[model samples]
Target: MDRSKYTILVADDEELLRWSIKEIVSRKGYRVVVAANGREALEVYHRDHPDLSLLDIQMPELTGMEVLKQIMAEEPQALVVMISAYGQVERAVAACRLGAQDFVCKPFDNDDLLRRIERILEPVRLRHQVEGLLADQRQRYAIDQIVGQSESLREVFTLIRKVAATPNTTVLITGESGTGKDLVAKVIHHQSARAEQPMVEINCAAIPEHLLESELFGHEKGSFTGAGERKLGLVERANGGTLFLDEVGDMALDLQAKLLRLLENRTIRRVGGVDDLGVDLRVIAATNRDLSKRVEEGAFRADLYYRLNVLPIRLPALRERHGDAPLLVRFFLDRLNREMGKQVRTIGEDALACLSAYAWPGNVRELKNVIERAHILADGERIEVSDLPAEVRGGGAGGAPAGVATATAFGLPEQGIDLEEVERRLLTDALARTQGNQTQAAALLRLGRDALRYRMKKFGMLE
Candidate 1:
């Protein structure tokens, strides 16, 4: 409400009316500028760029409608208020449709005009506040803000940078749970040209199947039970921005078809609505599941998978990103030090070794959680071996990660090994590696799919 920070432009052919308007607004502490006609109004507009413009409907050189059109074309969000005479109300309504934010009548009361301006600028103030918050978020989740330096992580960073430069390509981020897929999505959005706009996210797995279509495409009044009014969906809300679909592999089969149509046509029909609403959307789809495997299993649609996979980014598991544990540990410790008000300066070598050796099945999130627990449990100024959990202390001694025993460690019996059990173990390992995709498992075992399936059936492994 600091009126001094806001400037108003008063454009009228009548010099006396312009001066009177300036006096009225300037008395309220607003910085006021005046213009004699439509042509001069544009000059002042392009030059000073006032926060608001009050234009008279009838003006010399150019009509108010003409000025409105040019201004809107140049700056669509420009705040404009048309001044209309008694007979010019129709023109004022037309001006509203032409992108003027609001319209006021000639001989309008000084107080009423101020009130109208106040109401209009209030929403603008809210929007500015939202934009300021987004600025802070952009700094926090900036592209390079991800904390890691391993070679595998470097590749992901390179892809994120390349993908962010694209204007609006569909992006598919694949990674295990807790591997920061969602964070990568946010980083890409905030680093792109659409940073100033929104990045709306929805977890496809979390929403019920019955309501997901309604949530994504909205519904008209009386479209369904409890449908009382027309509603805009998430796609409409994110029309000018990004829509992040997390766990997209879990989306229902029926919805997958609708989503495919949306991607192909760039339009969506609200449930029970007759017309298709066009949308400009940058879809960033993410999944912890292996979508190729899902497609092979017929649980996910192949065409939709291909559409979403336009620009793919696969995040490596923490254990796969060799030499990153130390860096991540240091980063998390620094943050924990400030957060917990603890002064643990350094971790013992024994503790760091255990962290690096243990297979991070839960990935980076697990590491962060472990670090937090250590910060709380460390007795002295530094973290020692005793501060670590038992699993970390006993893991990774023989080059194999925790909980995974080597074949040599599971040594062949002195008498003899059971050939049947060995075959069963190999079959299970191959299936696990390929997430139950028969063709892929076959390739891994260097056997045909028929042979693999026959063996799996013999062992009661096939459903």
Candidate 2:
């Protein structure tokens, strides 16, 4: 490590001890700041903000314990080590309780003192690194990271902004699988008052019912078979932050009741623990299932349903937001290009049209997957229709007409024909045979009248 970046503070009333510490630490390439008394220590601390501090217990103006308390109150993360004589071991213990990192004895071996300081500073270095990583992750999940231009998606963004400003409001996001429900939950948490705190997530459906209770509420040591030590549950871990209960509809009825209690009381009891520990957190629950319908069917609790439905935000399915497909395609394309180190820039018109027309049953997630796959398989600078998945190219449910094989009456050609043009001509021919009779034309085309009318409108053959 480059010790030159670190600054250590040494505060001692004894000049000899203070000089000794400063000499030893400064030789390690660290900048050293010295203070002759506790009061001077606090003054230097506020001004310099050194990475670590070493203080003698028996000081002039203020004692080390008092100085430690003041430092902790001002800068909670400040690293301080107490220096005490052999007769002052009890006072050093007191200093540790007051947030001192570690203590060193007077007439202390220089090597032992140096080792203790290194141990304390090691965790501080690690914590800074971890915080940096977490900050980067939070940026990735920011509210603006969600991509879509459709009006329905805009409305969802409006709701997210409104709900996020209210730190304690419980959010219930309902949507189909792959519609970015989990992303929405994270956006809410990261943009809320508890953004600096941790956000704990649990997939209710992913965990087996037998072990879910212990997972949510935690289990005490020896609470069950093979329970070796106490474990903090997701609820306790999420205290003062956000708890995202994903696929909550799949949670068992018994566990649902326990969760309802926790929501109502803002307290949770571990599996085998007798005490009820209070928790302060916002609950954001998500599910693809129709919870109201489940309540009517007696599978879900009506009371819990009402409680969670307070700030309901329903996400529009990808098919419902057809206008967003092209934008989402470009978004994922750019992301995959950067990630996979591909030069695929723009998409071919045919590929773009195919993507816009397809009914993405899996929603935005499936679209992202398709884009990634295309980026990987693409041999040119642009993605072509042939680069897409067969289902997408066929456009069976997505919006295009059935594949060219459906036009086999004229035998298969070496090159495939446009399915939309073929379907349009077929519709016109059917209508012509029926003299423009709507019902008769539908029967000739082997399609329902409504289906025929929709096709007519889509092909611009309708007046």
Candidate 3:
């Protein structure tokens, strides 16, 4: 709606026509730059760099066709419209072949010219908007936003920078849940050459086993009972981009084989289709599970594990990073202030000490959640010790543990506690929450039913 920035170039031999076009365009708040001849038109073009140009076909010194050709050669993206008399249809065709966008005959209507100019500039406006949004996104996820100063974190940052420069090298990130594995994947992708393309993400543990295959590999319209139409798989949709497999350790064995084939052969076959389609992309997988352990247990394939581990990156849990608590706290506080529309600007030393003392079982994720909770609880500009959860005070009696996780993850207190006792309690809690449904409880605990049963049987709690 703001037309002030749009500049139009009106080049014509006839004085009246040139002034007419200029007056009509300038009234719409667009800046108008005019040239009396073709020779001067190219000069004005080089000087002003107009958004759109209207040229007279018959001009002294050079023809409109010559000017259009030279401009197209230098700037193929330039928008140009040629002006010709009624009998100059062949010349208009030639102008188009020379890269003119459109042509208007001599004695063109003022309103028609204005409308055409408006239509042509719509694409220019859209291009500007897309560029601006991508710029903001790049700034938002820049490597500096990680917010840490620890040596371990410094090492992780260095690895990220190195691996991001290499395209098509499969990367596997291993760390406890909430260790910012997902964030690191994004940083690698957005920093790489594939940033402009789509970065498709799927959680192998999130989707149900039966449908996940169809979701990843797509399906023909009649592939299965519920499939209504032909669907492009996530893998195909992500061609020339990235497919980030979060919790890839949980993917089915059959799908894992297919994925391995994709990595090796760069081709995918749809669920019920016969033809193999070649795909080009990068795979970045993240998991909280110890894949090597899983490989030993036969739950994951050894060959596939080796393939994915080509460029492995392990993100350390927040507890392992020394003295990053305060920095992370401040980072979340500043961001949460803007999001929650509150002025809780600072955290008292007492509260920060509590955060430091607590084992961040959930790592950076739990810390972020706690900061938001504190921001909501605080009535003043500062978050005091009392604003923190009791577990953060190391009370360990109420609410879920700050970093309380499944069988794979546990928050060990500074003073040692019985590990088996904690596991027994968590199993009981999950079972009770899911109303004694073993499968649902297993999912809630991020464990498979068999794994849950093994723990339950070990404790003689199997009913």
TM of each candidate vs. truth? 0.66, 0.70, 0.83
Between candidates 1 and 3, the one scoring higher on TM-score is 3
| Candidate 2 residue lDDT tens string, 54-124 | 98898999988889999999888789998899999998998888888788887889888778777888877
Q: For candidate 3, what is the TM-score? A: 0.83
Q: Give the Cα error of residue 223 in candidate 1, in Å.
A: 1.7
Q: In candidate 1, what are the lDDT values of residues 1-463, reduced to their tens digit?
A: 7788788999999888899889988999989998888999999999999989999989999888899999999999999999999999999999999999888887889999989888877877787778779889889889767988876688899999898899589999998788999999999999888888778899999999999999999999999999999999999988888999999999999999999998999999999899998998799999989899899999999999999999999887776666778888888899998988888889988788778767776889999888989999998888887787777776434244456555566667789988899989999999999888775676555454566778999999977
The prediction achieving the highest TM-score against the true structure is: 3
lDDT of each: 0.87, 0.86, 0.87
List candidate 2 segments past 4 Å from native: 1-5, 10-45, 54-77, 80-113, 196-198, 218-233, 269-277, 395-463
lDDT of 3 by residue, 375-457 (tens): 99998999987788888865543333355443345566789899789889989999999889775586566554567888999
Off by over 4 Å in 3: 396-463
When summed lDDT is taken over every stretch of 10 residues in candidate 2, the lowest stretch is 396-405
Q: How many pairs of residues collide in model 3?
A: 2
